[model samples]
Target chain A: MPGKSADKKPSFSDTFSVVGGNFDDAGRVSSRIKGILKKMCLPFEVIRKAAICTFEAEMNIVCYAQRGDITLSVDEDRIVIEVVDQGEGIPDIDLAMQAGYSTSTAKIREMGFGAGMGLMNIDRYADDFDITSEVGKGTKLVMIVNITEGS
Target chain B: MELGFIVKNLKLMVRSGSENLTVDVNGGYVGDLLSDVIANSKQGDIWITRQIHQNIVAVATLKDLAGIILVDNNEPARETLEKAIREMVPVMVSELPCFETAGRIYQLIAAREK
Candidate 1:
């Protein structure tokens, strides 16, 4: 298995900040993270999955939050991405998880986003996913992608 | 089929990454929704859309798409074109509507397959 030998400690880690309502630079952080992963020479599948999850998380922060931070840490066996945002948190996680349910405004839709599929896309790509939010506090997401098969 | 051929056959205006048009196009995907494109677009598939945002360039890069074709004469945002040039992802424009552009490209690829 690549990146897996004897140690399981993280070999690379980085955190990126996203400012809410900053549509001009929404996906820049995700692009940088993708570049980092590509340089690390991680498997193409792993890099693609991690990039998709992080991009969705970053978009959520840009669309809804006041500000947020995305942290990416890669170890021998897995890649972990955590996004924490200060925003108008989702009131109903179950409802929000449903595809095609969105609270986005006209401007967001005009930008070709906010079709209510971001969270679901992240879930579909991540090996393990966790989400928690408070009504007015913020939303937090943790997504992990395993490197080794069935590990 | 290669992206350059599509550009020539469709009479597309190359806006950025002109040198990168030789990339092979395995298929095509038409969608304006960013998430839909990101989730469903396959590698080497030329993406057809009406959106001209800089984010479209990001999606194209992330998905390893063959390139992006903007329909209805929609020009990309200035920053979008710059980013496309920098990332070496070809961006083209077509005067036709999204449906017609998609249909023509689909026919081209389908014909090549046979």
Candidate 2:
């Protein structure tokens, strides 16, 4: 079956608050994105994966950046989420992206997250993952998922 | 035991606006994460948590929960409450912390069902 192609794209700008280092505030952002995807009738599995990825990325912001925001752009064929934060930059992007690698504080681990699976999970779920970090400057993550591809 | 007894024991408020926090809950599960709660909680079980976000409703719906009880006297944001009301899933507010609320609900469920 051929998919419908559209020349026009719908864009949305939404901001969610990430509390400073609070486990309670985790996953709030992803939930919003998930709701948006659901309203658009996207596949449940894809939404689920995106939710998980967004959560880990947002948590990274809270744990390291102290506060952050996630901005999303949805097009006909892809969903692009940009997680930007002014938190301390990843000292080693390679180490951070490695599965089971985490710089979480003890407090975060106690809350049942931060087991070092955040970034790797993001990579596994996102079709495209890019991270730009400076040791002291900050970090920006761009994740693009093509939902119609592998299905 | 009927659901009325459990509601009487906890003195819970029906925040879901479904006309009852009064459903018979068969078991209890407590977790802040939606994924864990979705994976662990069984149907007819009461979910106890302090997360008062809108997504909690969707998780509860997916898991087919009897009701959701927000512990620690936490109030969900207005928007979340509005959605829950629309979903017709009963929500309760309790002063007890998550742990205590879980125990109380469990004891109530077990006692009534037994």
Candidate 3:
């Protein structure tokens, strides 16, 4: 089981790798992350929110990056998911964060994604969200979801 | 409502995950956007959409949805069927359009609640 002691420090951490342009395996990491979080016995709301954010972040990597890694860490106080991808990074973070803005290709749209809501959705679910990208390099996202209710 | 009941009532053709038809469906959501469905759909809500890509299965799995009904007679792609089967996420087909499909399912769920 996941580690949980009297102190509220992180007790679990694992990183899952994701390959870019592999639509066939997209969301695999997120699903595994969800399973891990479930085993940790977090609240339903926290698991759902974390799963949603992780899935969106994973999708972004599969659709845009060459490769990526998602690190999931949990503690008594919060769950932290960090996604780092090697891909063509976003040129304009502000525009990309918009609800309907997207740079996805027609193929991505045909797959029912790239509506420009991935980042926004991640931001919505995460209690703390941060994103950074370098053009032609890569992007990194950090999302934290508090384990306590309303904390 | 049980997923099997909805399939029988709606005459939805189960394309994959036949063993999972026994699962319970708590509600219904109709949308083609993956993000919208992931963001708003509750667990056990049967998702109705026209998208047939494999990613649809991924979304359904992530949300713990009861199942997916592809409206407008859209057929699930080969890869989609494989993924759905592997994930045990039911994928069904409906000849009706999204509007009609969502309306009928909504009525059924409402009637059940009433």
Candidate 4:
């Protein structure tokens, strides 16, 4: 008979570094996380949604925060991600959540994002999202996606 | 040549899936707006645009396109370029604007199939 061995299975995890306001390195973190999720053969739709969510969070780091980190952990039941950034904290989280409220500069607008959909997209895609911030300190985002029972 | 060939001929760098450059382009789509591209771009088709942000990569990655071409000498921000290179997705830069680049790509892909 198997003892405690049956209870332990190999765990899969991934972490990525997102530099602060570094346009040159902006999406690297999200792309890495996206690749691993794909290789795992997770649901295509789910992965796509998560990619959008991740990108929004990643962009926030590049735009608002000086630097950030994205962490991906796949448990038996859910996938959890934490986006931590130390930058000019959001002065008005509620305003930023508004669909069209954007603080993107001309430079950022030139790139075709910053229409103020970042937070909305993240909230829309993730099962749960929570943001904590201090005006001059920084912002911390916690997002989670529940794997559909058998999925 | 096919779209894939044009991507190769242009010496467009592959930022992701470097081993799988053999793309089958059913058609081509060019736009600067991420929403439009996301809404209209078909899977396995080449996408041309001038937007150079990390979001562009996210859009393409999610859209699952054949590749992305930053037309009119447009280059993504350093961070974006680095991400593209790391992802191994194909990206080409050209000095032609939206229309000319699309036309050339169209002609190339069309000529190949015939």
Error of 4 at A25 (Å): 1.2
Fnat, 2 decimals, each candidate: 0.68, 0.00, 0.92, 0.34
Can you list each candidate's DockQ?
0.78, 0.10, 0.90, 0.29
In order, the interface RMSDs are: 0.9, 5.6, 0.7, 3.3
lDDT of 4: 0.73
Total residue pair clashes for candidate 3: 0
- Across residues A1-151, which tens digit of lDDT does each residue of candidate 2 receive? 3554334454655667676566544555666677887798887666656666676677677677867778877776777788888777888999887766777777665554566667777777788899999877688899877778445
Model 1 per-residue lDDT tens digits across residues A40-146? 88888888888899889999999999999999988867888999999989999999999999999999999998999999999899999999999899999999988
Task: Point to the candidate with the largest DockQ.
Answer: 3
Model 2 stretches with alpha carbons more than 4 Å out: A1-10, B1-114
Q: What value does the lDDT take at residue B14 in candidate 4?
A: 46
Tens digit of per-residue lDDT, candidate 3, span A61-92: 99999999999989878899999999999999
* Ranked by DockQ, top first: 3, 1, 4, 2
- State the displacement of the C-alpha of residue A50, model 3, in Å, after optimal TM-score superposition: 0.4
Model 2 agreement with the true structure over B14-50: per-residue lDDT tens digits: 6774665556666778887554564456767778888
Per-prediction TM-score to the true structure, in the order listed: 0.94, 0.58, 0.94, 0.71
| Deviation of model 2 at A126, angstroms | 1.0
Point out where model 3 deviates above 4 Å. A1-9, A149-151
The regions of model 4 sitting more than 4 angstroms off are: A1-14, A149-151, B5-21, B27-30, B33-43, B52-63, B72-88, B93-114
lDDT ranking, high to low: 3, 1, 4, 2
Candidates' C-alpha lDDT:
0.91, 0.71, 0.92, 0.73
DockQ of 3: 0.90
